[model samples]
Target chain A: MTLPAEYLATPRLPLDEDGGPVFSAPWEARIFAMTVKAHEAGVFTWGEWAEALGAELAKDGDGSGETESYYDRWLAAFETLLTAKNVAAAGQLADLRKAWDKAAKATPHGKPIVLENA
Target chain B: MSAHDHDHPHDHDHSELSEIELRVRALETLLTEKGYIDPPALDELIETYETKIGPRNGALVVAKAWTDPDYRERLMKDATAAIAELGFTGRQGEHMVAVENTDDIHNMVVCTLCSCYPWTVLGLPPVWYKSAPYRSRAVRDPRGVLAEFKVELPDDTEIRVWDSTAEIRYLVIPKRPAGTDGWSEERLADLVTRNSMIGTGLALDPSSLEDAA
Candidate 1:
């Protein structure tokens, strides 16, 4: 499938390659799809996402200039936009983060990590 | 693009979870609970990237390239069209470049700006690829990173590092092993590992396959 052509405009980031989206983990794909879905739903404009994501990318100002947790930065930008758009509350996200951490700790390995109360 | 320093989820053990795994789960739960994301759709998406589209596709391409000289030339001349010829195209791999590993030079891929990997062919970028250490160091010290991966090239072998981005993706066509002279594409495909295609490791040797078989 052809990717959205608008994504081609992102100058610095587009030194990209072809084929469908790939993620190292399920969550990476989830978050990536979510962002695209949200944009499609008009939750926020692409410009809005770029600005928000740009700010997050620019935060690591150490001039040594490195890429770290690319998806983590993406997640942060998504969170920022979601909250700014009031789609989800910041405190709610925080609470869920803690809850998952607790749930994950309680669960054994190789088992599907689920939040019973979530 | 390659394996991580720490153990990630594999077929054998899913017990040891990373912090990112936990955080991702948390985020998913929160988003799902808030009705921001549809659980069914997310599942489909994950399943697609996880199993439906991954390194296996690239393996097919590599295997075919290994067995067919004409296909290899086409792959080198135009990876996108060549890859598409085998029916692997879409999202993370709209623009594809295949770099061949030769006796004189080895090619490695890293996205210093972000984990810009050829997801369609590679499955997912490994956790280590996205890690800050690998991103920064892969460029500064390719030989050191190769050493850590147990891939020691001779001093005369030049290493060409390809930096990926959102627009283009790269696949490393590892040199075929010696003993597989008349191997079929199917058998050759098994020797093409994700790591081998990323230039972090070499293709499995025939002797190793014999031992395993």
Candidate 2:
């Protein structure tokens, strides 16, 4: 039940009491489900997805990055795989991103931001 | 901001999520708009991953095998089919091989290449399971690794480390603990830890559960 002072002082991810991964934000779980759902729909194979993820993680070299960045890589690689597989074009996703920014701003403070609001 | 902190909770609602969150949301919305993903299916996927589809599924499979001799025989003969019969079949679980722990042989699983786990049953592999150290040590110094997990075994016991691959994954059936011979599979499942199914840990001692309760 003891620990090195430096290791204990270091910032760490928030884990559930039972040590399950606690998604810091809801969107982390959303993206996770999106990846699984995409695979189920045959947008890409698990092999391709793994390769894409490996490629993205390899960008981190020693893989000492934080857990948050891991999911960033996950999302980046997912987008790459979708584009490479001709499932979703880069431009379309970018446009949607802009649309969401506007939609989020135009909507009331606490309301859900829908595409039509853009 | 501090003055109204407790009163104005919506003050920073827009800033709650990071840029990446917004990006992922955008991606999901775009995919739905373009017909690549159905909202209902996406919802179900989120729900399944969040609520169902985890170690509980594997725990159930192990409990069934422990309580029923025929089910145990089926699981040993054809893990994938028997597992699927219990409604956990998809993704990385199309092919499964179940190994049993006994008084002599102990089983452990590791993916030396990448983290290829029985996701349909165990959900996702733990962060350590995907770490380089685990991937290496699980194969090289299994006893030492198990010792680190606080799982000490007799020196004479043999440890068989199964390498999980995308083609085939493993589910370890830890030996049923003595006592409570008349336990239902559901209650027995409460003793099955995720690591037990993965073979890195053992079934919870019934007494331990009692102490926790």
Candidate 3:
């Protein structure tokens, strides 16, 4: 299967063997697929995604000295793209995130997180 | 694994929500609620990586090398090509190196900077692999790190730790366990654990396999 070249060809993208992107947590995969799907659905061009993600990676030092937090920057770039494209308002996203934190706090460990106010 | 003094007490606490975990969950919820994501598709993608694509591929490679001396020599000589011959190649494993563990030597894999792992074979790294304690201690005190994992080696066994990078990744070819003569590759593969390949544990003994079953 052909994945997005914009991400695959990017030197910064860290993929697993088989060329698919690797994620440390389920949420990483979730954000990643969302970004790919968003690009596929014409919400933004691959160039835009690449530029935003590239900037994020460079800003964070790109695993030279520390390798953690690549996907964290990815999420930040994804949000930036969403807000820039007007696909989702920054305030709305922030509000939902806060709501999730509250839900997660109330829920016990090993249980799936469900947003109460969403 | 037993609690030890070397354990980094400030490392990730399993009891509470990690900052990344909480943030990712929030993002997922927001995206799904906004119609930017399909819940089922996301689930399928995650499940594929978590289960279908993981260390089983590495286990198969280890099993083959254990059974064939020539293959073992080839694997040790040129790991990237040898692993590719077995159809395990890509991403974090572009440049691969195999370090063999013998009676006199032991090898361990760690990424001091970040969690640069051989995902093509081993899959996503376990939480402990990415913890700060492991990243730092694996380089400083490998034996202490192994002890926390309950892996005790003989005093004379020299330990060689490989620090992974984005350019190259190392996989430990753990020595084959005894009493498995004439065992099928599939059965032998089942005895290989993720920890064994990482040098934090050893291949399972045949009797333990029966007990596990």
Best by DockQ: 3
The estimated TM-scores of all candidates read: 0.54, 0.54, 0.56
Evaluate model 2 with DockQ and give the value. 0.13
List the pairs of residues colliding in candidate 3: none
Q: Could you report the Cα RMSD, in angstroms, for every candidate shown?
A: 15.5, 21.0, 12.6
Off by over 4 Å in 3: A1-118, B1-52, B113-115
Residues A1-118 of candidate 2: C-alpha lDDT, one tens digit per residue: 2222322222232334554344433355578668766776777766677778878888887777665577778789888888888767658777777877777666543343567832
Error of 2 at B182 (Å): 0.7
lDDT of 1 by residue, B1-213 (tens): 221111223332223335665556666676666666787676555554554234478888999998898999888888899999987775334577888888998999887422256766777656566667887788899999999999999999999887664455689999999989889999999888888888888888878878998
The candidate that wins on TM-score is 3
For B98-126, candidate 3 gives per-residue lDDT tens digits of 88889998999987423356777786666
Worst 10 residues of 3 chain A by lDDT: A60-69
DockQ for each numbered candidate: 0.14, 0.13, 0.15
Docking band of candidate 3: incorrect
lDDT of 1 by residue, A35-78 (tens): 77667767888888888888887885753322235567877888
